[model samples]
Target: MSFRDEVEDGRGDLRKPFLHTGSWYRMGSRQSSIMGSSQVIRDSSISVLACVLIVALGPIQFGFTSGYSSPTQSALSKDLDLTVSQFSLFGSLSNVGAMVGAIASGQIAEYIGRKGSLMIAAIPNIIGWLAISFARDFSFLYMGRLLEGFGVGIISYTVPVYIAEIAPQNLRGGLGSANQLSVTIGIMLAYLLGLFCSWRVLAVLGILPCLILIPGLFFIPESPRWLAKMGMMDDFEASLQVLRGFDTDITLEVNEIKRSVASTSRRTTIRFADLKVRRYWLPLMIGIGLLVLQQLAGTNGVIFYSTTIFESAGISSSNAATVGVGAIQVFATAVSTWLVDRTGRRILLIVSSFGMALSLLVVAIAFFLKGFVAEDSSLYGIFGILSVVGVVCMIVSFSLGMGPIPWLIMSEILPPKIKGLAGSVATLANWFSSWLITMTAPLLLAWSSGGTFSLYTVVCIFTVAFVAIWVPETKGKTLEEIQHSFR
Candidate 1:
């Protein structure tokens, strides 16, 4: 049975706004209440910025965990005497662990509040890294990867929600983008550092972000919305006050938040049966489709084994090339942040998917040609250069849109009521697809690098069609308007 069909027990409505928790906070009961009150007063952005930066450490650690495998693959495998299959398992195990963590993430965040969920995530990440660092055998290494993946799964959901809940609307998009940007930064850090350190030393270094985040979490106030949701009104007001600065009046924003919370809290838990309606199922399908396709393009396969991919391409400085790709990913993602709002979601996605398809096709063809020429021949060297160029362009294309837009569109399109459950389903699909790609990438490369990427190229081509036909233009429309169009 499929995930959607089998998980239909629908025990309860997800009690939290799992995707973008604070989107409703911007809803006001009266337009004048938003405009005429002293509550309209602006607070210093400093405090909010501080909180975001502190929590951003979580995504950075997440990126570090992901990029860790690529740089350390050779060293770790040699040190532990692991075969190719064993090493692939080591790389893919985190996605399995992350799947477990993602499943539990929403409820955990709901039960304990956003800050608490992050603390919960951080502990496992620390333990996971230490385990990897101290490992003497595959058992420790595998366990560590799983632990790290589990931590990342929770972080994947919680950090963005937490940042959204705290930030003002004006700052929300930019600040939320930080989560992804930090992740790329973290990946680059791993690639750069891996060039010098042993795998063990790199694992130890991975623990540093969480170590700082734990104590830092203590200083930042909890999400006011989460506090309000849990019926801690006094704490909620105080938390909002702290976030807004000491003297900024929060009465207007508070009333709006209370109204939103009251309306939301009264909602009946959604059931899978409700998805029979086109309005519900359509968005859910689009959300899951985008997420799954994002992974099926084999981005993680390339990322997890980038150093090995470079080596196979006959690049002399494969590790350095890996570091270069990581740096390019960071820059490309930053450019994407600027382009997403201005250019709109659908355009970027179409462009991204098409670009990836074109880029992968180049890689596939280059690899195919490499087989025809002698290794020392000039033509073979040209194919090798073409492969590197293709990989770099593919990553740049992915960062431009596919990397961030799927989640953005998912959050924008999913109905608020079923966001918790539906978002989980979508997230699970993404992790599962990632696991499949990462697990098979090494074996596929062993079989035929050209064939492996040719498959991805077809997936990306399908993605371009999917986005163009099925995905709606969500830019410049309210959630209600977007939903209405679906109806």
Candidate 2:
């Protein structure tokens, strides 16, 4: 029988008829209706609250490291006697590690299961934090940061997939946004801790969340969808029972799983070969384009060099400048979470890019004007105020656009069969672009601050064009629905 006919007839295991070949498949139409009713009941069992708690644990670590690293850069540079080049190398090295981790973790998640991978990812993350807190040398600090990046990369790629797989179709967007929200909260917490306490103390404190998360692993069930793929039908049903909360139509779930596995089995594992095809090329380009745009908008440049930006604006005190930048990032990201779902991804990208382009223009103008100013106090004051406004506008624009959308889109787009691989590629692109941006910003600043902002303005314009051409509206689609879009 055809796939559609089987589906309509309630013969859910159409692809793998043997899996349900026993008495289970012989049940009458009444039995099918009862099973369908049970699935509806089972669907009601999945708790949004539990899923939120599990997903939030991973992003907290991401936010803590991303936000806290900026404030510590000055201290690290001074303590390690880093020249400008060496300091830039530090940022590049972390992204290198993240790129490696993102690629490796996809295969790792397939083998170990998402929860297992999450548990393992946290161990290195906790250790990395502890190492940074006590590091006495540049190499030690670099190693610690590298490990932390690896952990972040793994969690970043995995947690969204896990949450998306487990969440009810209706709630996935909010839960997905929760991951972003937790990251913001973590950023805010790290910023607050860095402001009030020692960097070492804040680094050590960052590891505490892992302690809470490690225990959660035991309670949360594996993705029922994953179990179905393994041909462990019994375990798959059991997982669905626990996750969904009632007995489900195992046949329907199994059929969906069979279709997924059948489709995936036809292709080789993630490789360069996968990108050689016309069908895959567009998605790959879109993924990489988003990554490049995200970095070119100067989000990481701002994040890593926020202190320097603030100081250049005439905040002479180093500590206060770092704290101020951190505060701005925290508040901006918090606002992003609220606006992301409501504004839709495309509109936010367009509006924010416009804002960023305008902000960069202002900065370039301010710097150019500063060069012509005589040693007049009023001129200096005016230049400083303009510079501060420029930086604030840039931060707000970035938080709204580049900061959240890449992650959100990466998690949502692409077929499930290639999600792990596609996500890795996108994430790798993100980290590598971030590395280049961070590594070059200091040199760019020193060479020609006005020229640096001008370059970013140009890139932001390209970002606007790319979004208009390639990005699809994924604002309210289910995972199954999203996969169908690519098909």
Candidate 3:
């Protein structure tokens, strides 16, 4: 079904997801009252812990589903008696399903709060894992995989937004970075576990995160920003109070959120036509641009064909190389989580994009050298090692910034009203680019591995320039402050 159909709320009405326009923060209009800083520090630490724990599950599930098929590929093919072409389709179907989910996610999050959207996503994931575990036919397997993909697509948009909204300004970037860390961790878990478990058991493991999240949702507060936007004043205040701590003197914050919400109340339904305004379109471009460049930088090209890349690098154990890649991703993302708050988003992105570019250039050079050297020569061996180093560098460089920052910035920059629409568009563009890059990667590799990476190198270089020129430092600003900074 189309997203229009999916967006129909339980009340049988299509709730238009609104985009907030103009500078609504209007700080002068709000009153300020200071709460005891020490009291707030003491209480809010525990307050948001549950929220982080729960929301992080979505990313873990994303990683798990992504890493699941890697080790299970042969078993899936053998058991289903699938041809290479059919197996390739099975592997990529998640992207197709993800595109659908990405399109529908904004509206889903709009109708339901961020928490509710996550809860909705969890159902599909749980059911998908169960179906995958129990499947006796290809149809069940396909449906299960698609459902898991759809769930993650929804999770992809919702988790970062949720974290950004609820997190204190000082901690937003670091917390947002956690989402990517969870993704890497989930991927590592799947890869490590897939070695010991059967495909069915691994599928069952995929269900566990959602199982934890389903119950955990109840214990956390919804996004106060979303609550206020819906004009649910009581719940809004309650959620914010809970997030900040009960006695954290939320008067100033409450007034700020109320004013933003009050301004948004008038523009409750965003039509496709409404995006014509420069305000809406500008952020859309930024969000979509980052996502596209993130893909065009060819992170997926490396990921989908890491084994081939390792072999081409003259690595004897392709599996070990792939495992090393996953390990680096997890480590780099952990470092990103620490660095994001300190360095801010823009610098990290510029650095990441540039680093990846240089890394890709090295790989291109190594491959170019490989073409010239005899396979038995010591020079070829050196080039082979260089290729492996370049591959690791590329993955590390990507994990540091490009992997997490685009979604973080997208969540931070878009006003709540337009977040659903713009986020959906950006995410859809991401999935489409992923599909395009994945589809053409083998041909590109065949035509020239050096040339393929050179193309990505150019894109990565452009990404650095883009970040330097266009992306803002969203390090410690309130959501309202960050959105208005774009103005």
On lDDT, the candidate that comes out on top is 3
Give the residue spans of candidate 3 off by over 4 A: 1-42, 266-268
Ranking by TM-score: 3, 1, 2
Instruction: Judge candidate 1 at residue 17 and give its lDDT.
Output: 25
lDDT of 1 by residue, 129-241 (tens): 99999999999999999999999998887787777678765555556667788899999999999889999999999999999998888767788877676555656776787
For model 2, the superposed segments whose C-alpha errors exceed 4 Å read 1-46, 74-88, 232-262, 266-268, 321-324
Tens digit of lDDT per residue, candidate 3, span 359-431? 9999999999899989999999999999889989999999999998898989988877778787888899998
Ranked candidates (lDDT, high to low): 3, 1, 2
Clashing pairs for model 3 are 18-417, 19-417, 19-418, 20-417
lDDT score, candidate 1: 0.80
lDDT of each: 0.80, 0.70, 0.82
- Winner on TM-score between 1 and 2 is 1
Q: Model 1, which residues run further than 4 Å from truth?
A: 1-45, 224-262, 266-278, 473-487
Pairs of colliding residues, candidate 2? none
- RMSD of model 2, in Å? 6.9
TM-score of each: 0.84, 0.82, 0.90
